[model samples]
Target: MQRYFETELLDVKNFELPKEIYKHAIVVMRAKVGDHFELVTADQKVHLMEVTAITKTAATAKEIEVFEQLTELPVETTIVCGLSKGDKAEFIVQKGTELGADHFVFFKGEYSVAKWDDKKQKKKLARLEKIALAAAEQSHRTTIPTVAYLSSLQELTLAADEKGLIAYEEAAKEGEKGALVTLLKEIKVAPKETKRPKLQAIFGPEGGLAFQEVTALEERGYIRAGLGPRIMRAETAPLYLLSSLSFALELR
Candidate 1:
């Protein structure tokens, strides 16, 4: 069955589809009254829905089943990357959502090759948000990942209990490979006071993170971790982190 997001969650068991979703299902997909599809509501609940009725302007679906099935990572993950040029950011949000990223942050690095002015930030962020939403639906995710931008590294902030990691290529070269594993194991026992357990990993742009920026993040309690021995491109490193997290948390 196909899946789509419902922005306004309804209390009624039978609900009407929004205009855009109506156009896609009723008009574009040419779905009939008996067809079924999965629906993710605002409350993040997944509903197996069956189309019950259709009018000229809208269609309705009856909630067939409510699924409590887990489709998200056990730990909330935010992938932070230094803003890069071209379509890299879009690729990160698109593929990252499929790989279970809960959120994405892009910031201006000391050696950033691309710049996003205020207007560009708004436009690009809007486009990226759409990419995240579509990817989430396509990936059958219960929750849609968010995309955000920061002017500089200084603007990036973390909660006291949130585990933060900076992907440092230098750490990989120095044979530092245990930090990521250690952090993954430790976050399971992170302070219980943390309302939403979070793990945010930072990656640099094509030019990589500046040494001073790494030092500052370390001072703020972010661990510098190496993703194996080989150096990955800025976009590749976050995906590696997510894959590792899934293997350690989901598989084991």
Candidate 2:
């Protein structure tokens, strides 16, 4: 079943679909009365809704079943990526959402090649938001991840706070490992009963983080962690980190 999001899905017993959703379901998808689809409301409830009526400008659906499912990371992990060139940020956001990232943040790294001015930043953010929404629906996620941009490493660290990690290539070469596993172990216990741990991991752009940036992160209480023995690209690192999180937190 297709999934749609509405802020007021549970406002009434049955609600008229939004204009964009109505057009997609009626005109593009050719959905008719009696068809069933999923609607995620403001409170993050997923309901199997059956179409009750359709008009030129509106479509109405009522709940048939409420799904008691949680398709999110056990820990509230946020990926803070250093700004990279081209569509790298888009790729990261799309795949990262599917892989269960709670939030995505991009910052201006010292070695970053791409710069986002005010106008372009807004446009890029809008595009990334759309990609995240589509990916969330396709992956059957209950919530769409938030996307944000920051100015510097200092701002990023402040936003993430003490519960953060930095993916450094030197750590990989140094044969340092298990930092993430240890962190996950400390947070993944009895997830249903315990408060969700908020974690943020930072990654560098094309040239990777400067030594001073890594040191600064360490000084700010971010533990330096390695993905594995292999080095990953600007886009690949976040996907790898998210997948690892799934393995440690969800699959295990």
Candidate 3:
């Protein structure tokens, strides 16, 4: 069954699919009346839907069952990377979304090989956003991660309740590995009214993050953490982090 994230499914029983979703449901998927699919609404609940009607240009579905479940990371994660050359950003966003990242952020690092100017920033973000949406749906995620850019590393900041990390290759060289382990080993507790804690980790581009850039971010409360003894490519590091997080936060 196909799954879509819909923000307008509240207090409603039946509705026409959005234009994009209509095309996918009616034309692409060849769904007929009485067919079943899934919808994840703003509340993050999964609803089983039955196709109620279908026209050449439109389709409608009705929710018959709602499943209250959690399909997100125990802690919200934001993947912040220095802009890279080529399609690395898209690859990162796609795989990262599937692996349960809550947000994706790109910034200009002191050693970044690519740059997004004011003229093309919107277009770049749009492409990444599309990839994230597809990956989220394919991965059966209830929420789609967001993509955004920062003008510079200095613009990156975290809330007092959030944890921030910088994936500095040098940390791995110096055998500094306790920060990430400690973070993952500790227990996280929150009241029903509050949300899980958030984590935002930064990765460098091809040449890796400059020491000075790491120093500046450290001042903003970002701790330097090592992924492992074996260094990873710019695009590979974020996925590694997401997998480790899933192992500790989800599987454990």
Q: Score each candidate by Cα lDDT.
A: 0.88, 0.86, 0.88
lDDT of 3 by residue, 35-56 (tens): 9888888778898999998877
- Cα error, residue 232 of model 1, in Å, equals 1.1
Clashes of 2: 0
lDDT of 2 by residue, 173-211 (tens): 998798988887777663455456788999999889999
Give stretches of model 3 more than 4 Å off: 10-12, 187-193
Report the alpha-carbon TM-score of model 3 versus the true structure: 0.95
Error (Å) of candidate 1 at residue 33 is 0.7
Candidate 2 pairs with clashing backbones: none
For residues 141-237, write the lDDT of model 1, one tens digit per residue: 9899999998888877788668899999999999998999888888666665535578889999989999999999998889899899887888888
List ranges where model 2 is wrong by over 4 Å: 10-12, 158-162, 190-194
RMSD, each candidate, Å? 1.7, 1.8, 1.6
